[model samples]
Target: MEGMTDAPESQKRALRAELRERRRIRTASEREREGTALTQHLIDLTSDLGARSIAAYLSLPEEPGTRDFVEWACENGIRVLIPVSRADGLLDWAPYDGSDEDEDLLGMPTPTSELLGPIAINSVDLIVVPAASVDRTGMRLGWGRGYFDKTLGSMENCPPVYAVIFDDELVDSVPSERHDQRVDGVVTPSGIVAF
Candidate 1:
């Protein structure tokens, strides 16, 4: 019975490896085109949701881009908060007020502004996250990182959380564990997919 508990996690690891390879091989021009489409979709989502404040991530090069959308949101007076990882496995957020950038504990790019406690996420009307893949049911598969799962699980009054991915990453099924959390929807280069 105990061995059963490891099955999903092992399956997730293998799947993540495959997804990472796929993303890593995308051409730069293709990524740029996808980024443009993704930016428009994110803008539309925030507009539709009437979200004045949003929590989002700084995308890595291989991931679907979020920088253009973040830039647009800040320029338009919409508040944006980027996550900073803590050693305790919780996320602290910082306002991205068109400020300079710094690396978070995990070395991800974050804002250089003052840090806000973990609960700061509650104030956001929308949250956009990065994912290796998200299933049709909204189950997100990250790169073996539990940070997002922990954050989403601990939220008591979480707003709409969405994952950013390319269209192909939206799979029919993904391995899930008891601790894995689901997003409310996904934003792909194709469009927004609501679960």
Candidate 2:
């Protein structure tokens, strides 16, 4: 993990807003192409890592798309687990069966399948997460929520944790704190960056 952040929370928030706005203005065709490239990269990562079961998330409309990858994993007999946000500032893991889903308390997409304990993620071979931005050193700036931070921080022998973002979101630096967890690498439309 990276050291204590050189940037403050306010700085982080401002950057997140700018990034989100940039994503919001992308043309539909652009997003589709990026999502396709992103799906291939994710599939390559899983294949390279030889993962049998993985933890991943459903992408939001403006985020780098993981939906296609998640669905593909389900169809390929890969045991996929998705996150369910809990009121306690932690996450619950649920088996992703390619079933209709529900949004969590935070309005993020979540599975309605049978829920597992938080540590259920421990068994997965890999964990793919969402991020607003990630720095060159692997420090991730999540979207204002500590959910991924807490989940990753609490892991015992956590697998290779990778964040999904657009290629440009890979920047020189991002505002991070002591609580922020650095990822093993990141997957983007252009390719994967293993930090």
Candidate 3:
């Protein structure tokens, strides 16, 4: 991750608030267009990498949506695993059936199917995570929760992990700590960028 954070937790909170507001102000059409482009970029990347199984997240309203990409992956015989947040800050995985019928946890949609436990991430070839922002150095700023940080750290030999964000969310720097696992790359509407 980025060497000791230049900003404190309070600054991180302020940045998150500003980014969330900007995301919330976007029109539905703009979000849809960006989501579509993002899906295409991801599809191309996965195809290039020959990935069969991917661990992904169900995006929130203000975050770049992944439902379309998840459905497309399933239709094309790619296994898609989604996360279910646990009270202890760990993630439980479940196969995505391309259904929007899910419950909200901490304001984000989660699968209600039989959980496959957190280790399920170990079997996936790639991981697609949600991030509020990421730095050029690959440090990810999550929604103040350490779920992904914990999950990624626990993986045996974790596959290539990627964070999905909007075009503007990819920046020059973000506050990150030692425990925060850095991603291999980021996927935005414009294209994918690796650190």
Candidate 4:
């Protein structure tokens, strides 16, 4: 059993190195194309699931895609939530309603809405997460802030976690520390990837 665990860890480290190298070579145009495709894929997934309430993340510089899923969710009457980071490295969710104006939080654009309040993780039916990279086993590599890890740890019966990544960023493994949270699914430019 110990050997089994070590094998995955070893593979994950190797995959992480490979992906980092690939990302270093990606151009601006390539990122744009991947982002558009990923956005569309997420929209399709949300529609298919008929998710009435979802908690999604605001994208960062390296992650591909826009918040079209949030807009679509609002139009379809599905409540959307985005994480608001606290100083202690935990995520507090705020509801997202469609609005042209958004608030800038930690350099990310967050939707402006009246649905601001404390959200119980169990109350959310679905969750869309942002990732720098993801592996086949649904493990995600974030910006290394440990924010999502701490937040997810607090949940007893949380919603399904979906990591959104560019197609090229999806690999067979990713280097995961003991504190890293494993996502339940991955949404890339091509399609939905389930571990």
* Per-model lDDT: 0.93, 0.93, 0.87, 0.73
Clashing pairs in 4: none
Off by over 4 Å in 1: none
Best-first order by lDDT: 1, 2, 3, 4
Please say which candidate is ahead in TM-score: 2 or 3.
2
For each predicted model, how many residue pairs clash, with residues at least 3 apart or on different chains? Answer: 0, 0, 0, 0
Span of 10 residues, lowest total lDDT, candidate 4: 113-122
Q: Residue 138 of candidate 3: its Cα lDDT?
A: 92
- Candidate 3 lDDT, tens digit per residue, 118-176? 88889999999999899998999988889999999888899999999998999999877
Order the numbered candidates by TM-score, best leading: 1, 2, 3, 4
**Candidate 3 wrongly placed segments (more than 4 Å):** 1-7
Pull out the clashing pairs in model 3.
none
lDDT of 3 at 177: 70
Residue-level lDDT of model 4, residues 1-195, one tens digit each, is 888768756765676566667776778898777877887888877777777888886665555665666777788898777777656666666677766446544656675654354444558778887776877888788766777777776678877888887677777767777778998888887888877
- Overall local distance difference test of candidate 2: 0.93
* Tens digits of lDDT, candidate 1, 1-195: 978998988998898898889998999999999999999999999999999999999888988999999999999999999999999989999999776998987889999999999999999999999898999999999877798999999999999999999999999999998888999999999999999
Off by over 4 Å in 4: 1-29, 100-105, 114-119
| Lowest lDDT block of 10, candidate 3 | 1-10
Candidate 1 vs 2: which has more TM-score: 1
